[model samples]
Target: MIKTENVSMRFGGLTAVSDLNIQISKNEIVGLIGPNGAGKTTAFNTITGVYKPTEGKVIFKGEDVTGAKPHKITERGIARTFQNIRLWKDMDVLENVLVACHLRMNVGVFAATLHLPGYRAKEKKSREFAMSLLDSVGLADLAHEPATSLPYGKQRRLEIVRALATEPSLLLLDEPAAGMNPQESLELMEFIGKIRDQYDLTILLIEHHMQVVMGVCSRMYVLDYGVTIAHGTPDEIRRNPKVIEAYLGVD
Candidate 1:
C-alpha cells in the first residue's frame, strides 16, 4: 500500500537516511527496527511529511505523494503517532478524538454557530463514531476524563484512537513501546495485532523493543547508521550477521 524508492534525508552535513527503499502491503504489519541513531524515526518522519525527503519518491496506493503536507497525507488515508505523546493534555479523551475527526467534519463555522440541521447531524454522527472508536480502544469509560488523568498505557492507546479517528488505511507508529514496562510492551504488541485485525489496517511501526518487533511484525528491516542492514521475517532478522553486527558490534 506504500512504497519508497531510494528515499534519502540529509540535514546539512549529515545524512540520516540514505538511499533506502521500502514497500509495505495491505493488511500487513511491518516493523522498522534499529539501534539509536539508526535513522528509523528519520525515515518515518520523511514518509509522513514531517520532513521532506532530500531525494527520491514516496508513493501511497499508486500515486506519488512525495513531499505532500502532513494533513494532505492524513487526508489520503495515512495517519501516524509520534515517538513522544502528542495529545491535548488539557482536553478529555473524547475531545482529543473529536479534534482529530474535525479534519473530516464538513461543517461550516456559520452553520455550526446557528446549529443548522446538517451541521448538528454531522456533529452527532461524528460524536457517535468517535465514541465507537474510543470503545474499540478500551477507552470508553475514560471518555469524559482529562487526557492527563489517564495512565501511560491508556494515553498511548488514546493516541492510537485519535489517529484512527482520521480513518487511515495505514498507520505509522513511532516507538509505541518506548516508555512501557516489559508486560506493557507485550500487551501492546498483542494489542497491535488485535487492532490491525479489527481495523484491517496496514501498519509500519518503529520500535526499539526487540520482543515487540519480533512478536507482532510479520517482517522487519534493521537499519544501521543511515542504511538498511537486513530485511526479512523476524527469525531471518534475528539470525542475520549484518543485523547482529549493527546491534551488538560483532560481539
Candidate 2:
C-alpha cells in the first residue's frame, strides 16, 4: 500500500538515505532493519511525510504523496509512532488517544465551546471509540492514568494505541521494541500480531529487536549505508551474506 521510488535524503554533506526503493503491500507486516546510522528511520520519516525526500517520489494507495503535509498523509490513512515515546505528557492515557480521534470527529470549535448537542454527541462517540482502541492494545485498565506516569514499556504501548486511534489503513511503527525487557518485548510482539490481524491493518515496522521482527513481520528488508541489501523472509535474511556483513564487521 506504500511505495517509494529511487528516494534520497541528505542532511548537509551526509546522505542519510540514498536511492532507496521499497514496496509494502496491504496486510503485510514488513520489517525495516539495519544497523545504527544505516538510514532505516530516515526512510520511515520520508515515507511518512515527516521529512520530504530530497529526490524521487513517495506513493501511497496508488497516488503520489511526495512532500504532502503530515496531516494530509494521515488523513489518507497513514499513521505512525516514533522510536521515543511521544505521548501527551500531562494527559490521561485515554485523553492522549482522544487526540487522534479529532481527525474523524465533526465537532467544530465553537460548538465544542458552547457544548452544543452535536459536539457533545460527537465527543461521546470519540471517547467510546478511543476507549475501545485503548482496550484493543491492552491498556484499558490504565485509561485514567497519567501518560507520563506509566512505565517505559507501558508508555510505548500507549503510543501504539494512540497511533491506532487514527484509524489507519497502514501503520508505520518506529522501533516499537526499543527499551523493553525480553518479556515485555515478547508481549508487544504478540499484541502487534493480534492487532494487525484484528484491525486488518498493514504495518511497516522499524525494530532493532531480532525476536520482535522475526515474531511479527512477514517479510524483511535490510539496509546498509542507506542502500537496499536484502529483501526476503526472516530465514532468508538470517542467511544472506550481505546482511551478515552489515550486522557483523567485515574486514
Candidate 3:
C-alpha cells in the first residue's frame, strides 16, 4: 500500500537515508531491519511526514504524500507507534485511546463544550468504540488505570492499541519489542500477526529483534549506515553475506 522511490533524507552534510526504496502490499507485514544507526527510524520519519525527504517521493495508496503533515498522514489512514513507549502518563488506558479516537470525531469545539446532542452522540460512540478496542486487546479491565501504571509489555501493547484507535489502514511500529523478555517477545510476534489480520492492516515494522522480524515479516529489507544492504525473505536474508557482515564484522 506504500512505496518509496529513491527516497533520501539529508541533514546538511549527513545523509541519514540514501536511495531507499520499499514496496509493501495491502495486508502485508514487512520488516525494516538493521543495527544501531541504520537510519531505520529516519526512513519511518520520512514516510510519516515527520521529515520531508530531501530527495525522492513517498507514495501511499497511489497518492504522492511527500512532506504531508503527520496529522494529515493520519487522516489519510496511517498511524504509528514510536520506538519508545509514549503513553500519556496522566491519562488512563481508556483515556489514552480516547485521545486518538477524537481524530475521527466530527464536532465543533463549541458544541462539544456545550454538550450538544450531536456532540454527545458522537462522544458516546467514541467511548463505545474505544472500549471495544480495549476489550479486544484484553485491556478493558484496566481501562481506568493510569497508562504508565501498567507493566512494560502491557504498556507497549497499549501504545499499539492507541495507534489502532486512529482506525488506520497502515500501521508503522517502531521497535515494538524493544524491552521485552523472550516470552514477551514471542507473545509480541503472535500479537503482531493477530493484529494484522484482526485490523486488516498493512504493517511496516522497524525492529532490532531478529526473531521477531523473521517470525512475522514475509519480506524484509536490511540497512547498514543508512544504506540498504539486502532485501529478501527471512531465510534468504539470513544467508546473505552482506547482511552477515553488517551485523558481524568481517576480518
Best candidate, lDDT? 3
> Candidate 1, residue 87: CA error in Å?
0.5
**How close is every model to the real structure, measured as TM-score?**
0.98, 0.97, 0.99
Estimate, for each residue in 1-96, the C-alpha lDDT of model 1 and write its tens digit: 999999999999999999889999999999999999999999998898889999999999999999999999999999999888999988999999
lDDT of each structure? 0.92, 0.89, 0.95
Off by over 4 Å in 1: none
**Model 3 TM:** 0.99
Q: List the residue pairs that clash in candidate 3.
A: none
lDDT of candidate model 1 versus the reference: 0.92
Q: Rank the candidates by TM-score, best first.
A: 3, 1, 2
Candidate 2 local lDDT, residue 238: 88
Ordered from best to worst lDDT, the candidate numbers read 3, 1, 2
Cα RMSD (Å) per model?
1.0, 1.1, 0.7
Strongest candidate by TM-score = 3
What tens-digit string does per-residue lDDT give for candidate 3 at 129-214? 99998998899999999999999999999999999999999999999999888899999989989999999999999998887789
